[model samples]
Target: MDMTPLLLAEIQFLASFSFLALFMALALALSWMLLFFKLRVRLTGDAGWTAAYRFWVRIFALCFALALAACLPVLAQLGSLWGGLMDKIGNVAGPLLGYAVLSVFVLKSCFLGVMLFGQRRVSDTVHTLSVFMVALGLLLATAWMAAVHSWMQTPDGVAMVDGRYQVYDWFQVIFNPSFGWSLSLTVLGAALAASFLIMGVTALQALRRPPGDGERCAFKTALIVAVLASLLQALAASGMGDVISRYQPVKAATLAGYWHSGDEPELILLGWPDAATQTNRVLLAIHDTGGRWLGHDSKGYLGLDKFTGPRPPVALSFWLLRVSALLALMMSVASVLTLMRTLRRRMDLAALGLFWRKVLVGMSFSGSLLVVLGWCVSLVGLLPYAVNRSINLSDVFSQATSSTLLLSIAGYTALYVVLIAAFLGMLLHAVRYGVVPVRKTTGGAA
Candidate 1:
């Protein structure tokens, strides 16, 4: 009755996602500040703003470096724990740990160096190159992580050789089912987050004072790019459907509240999920209940019932699947409408109307939160299956020793508590300080 393997797997997954969400949110907030400082520097032609901006970036660079450094060991442990639970090889811990540490240091230090290099000169080309290089490094690292995740989903081109898992054509594993769509969606989501933050910071500056010519010019340019990028992100996300439907139908159906296999499922709007019973208590009006809402006919809808009998909990799947899809739809609509209004010279319409400011913030925070949430629910939801796969209690008991199972779980709990505190503190500070004040300068930029 040692539930150590299952428990450890759950702990590692939860901890990794919790840390990642916190890191991204912090990074986004710092990016917003740096962008604002940079704008002030350009508008006033004052060295003070530039100095502040550089300092902020320096702090960001340092923090990101440290955060990544700390995550490497945890990530290694998580991989090892997951592998052991899956009955995979154990020797992967060494190579993976080394790679994780090396990748973080190399990537973070290189980006920091690029930022420092850009500060000493004023060439737009140099700045552009620096940004490009940083983007490239991030993409490479992301590709690696994506490969690992994709392998977890559809492990292709790998076979157990001589009692060890040997990867055949690593590229095949990397490009497994849904890899393209997943990678594209991930990159687009990152860009969307970055763009939204940029727009928000710029808009906050506009609210503080009427924009000067230089500020106005920069804001206009950024708005166009951000809006376009956001639009592209939505389109890219739509591409996730085909892949999801083909390979991960269960996930797709759950997200859409689609209870069946069919052509063109209608999305579910409001439904109360019962974890104890794999039934979605319908809420609100439903013109197309089963067919359109769950994307399945009467027979297809019955498939959902099959998912619920004494196995990995179907209730969580139903809930998370719906939540993730719902969030995606909401963000897509918000991004499009906001962009259209901004382009029409109705900044107020986009910024003020429909409580867009609050909505924007909510969307950003919710997106990050849901990622962690969905991951947790999914892992927990899968626990029963994992338990079923195990040989016996003795085998499981042996795996948990020296694995630091309880420690990982405790660490995850602590990290999440700290994250909530940090989030609240930021909100309070933002409200108290308000937007940064714009400085009037001796004339405009030369």
Candidate 2:
């Protein structure tokens, strides 16, 4: 197979997946936030909570719709661009994919309408329950998808028979070694991202008008969630390193920038991995920390040279890991600082200075940015193999012509660009108009 076409196909799939992941994260987080707002409305009957729900629901609806739309290309690509992957692992992949689709369809079709449009017609408790069901559906869908991808990263409970993987234990396959960490990280990342978006939007709204009760409630909630999620995400990330070291040492070494096997592996804080020379250039590192972090402890780990098989791209994985870590640190710091200020000063949106507000707006999408980079690190670190040590990507890539692959890539790119632009434009318009006034009936129904 020509590398040109194969690379193009990989790029195409990645492009589609990135778009899907972004909206999926937002949708999942927003669904739960919507539930929270509805629960508050039910418990307190505050019109402010009603206003918050009404405003945020529109954003959630847009995100959920885009997420659903994004799934189409990704699913299509499995059969169209990487049919061999399904051919080899269809026994494992098929059921997971079906479960994800079924969960989304059943939850959305059955309850999403009632949650979004039937709020007035139904009782408050019923509406709140419907919102819970919708959120549960999103959670299940994310778990199934994460299971499938995590299995690819660290395949388990499957035996290779005549060049194809066959599942023997469903539980082992679904709860693979990395599934827990992967799911936790993904969910936390989504929550953190959505929280920042809320903070930024709330701040923006505050700047435009006198800070309302709804804005203050949203800002406070987002700040608290962001603080918790970022801390949890960091811990989950550290634990994930142990999994990578245990199952994929080469990837671990690549991320740690360990070029040579030694008793003491230094943690490269800042450096350029020069593969040609097999050494880090302009190095700034902490000696012995890498060994501990990679779970080697006293026992030294294998370097790139020690791996007999093909190795992942060292520079790509190294820098992506570094950049993502930096981004996560920034998010953590910002969230913690903002949170401290709120606690000490009882700061509302109006009390937040102009500089801080602009900063919030700028960092609103930081969580989404981290999510994309984290995905890149995981996928790139698994280079040369489509399913751990079992299937090579070369074997799975479709034997399409380069020109054809390029054309499809162009088409997908254009479509996503337009869709993203439209989403942002509409989101901005919603923000500009601020919250829609909630009307109350004579019977005290919103």
Clashes per model (N, Cα, C within 3 A): 4, 0
Q: Which residue ranges in model 2 land beyond 4 Å of their true spot?
A: 1-3, 295-299, 345-347, 438-445
The CA-based lDDT of model 2 is what?
0.87
lDDT per residue as tens, model 2, 1-446: 35588788888888889889999999999999888887887788886787788889989999999999999999999899888889899999999989999999999889999987886677767778899999999999999999999999999999999888899999999999999999999999899889999999888877788778888877877888899999999899988988998888888888888877867677888999998888888468887667755535354667776678787889989999999999999999999888766776565677778888889999989998888888889988898789987798989887899889888988988999999899889988988886566453435545
In the predicted model 1, the residue pairs found to clash are 255-321, 258-294, 265-295, 266-292
Query: Of the candidates shown, which would achieve the greatest lDDT relative to the real structure?
Result: 2
Give the top-scoring candidate (TM-score). Answer: 2
Prediction 2 TM-score vs. true: 0.96
lDDT of 1 by residue, 1-446 (tens): 36556555655555765566345434434544455555565566665455445433543554354456446545565445544443453332244334544654575576546554544443433443454455455555556655555455445666766655566665676688757765665555554544454345444445455433433433444345445645664565566555544554444455554444444433446676564564567674345444322323355442444354333445555676556656656655666676666655744322344356545545545445444554454344334433222222233233555357677667766765675576456544543354353332333321
Deviation from native of the Cα of residue 424 in model 1, angstroms: 7.7
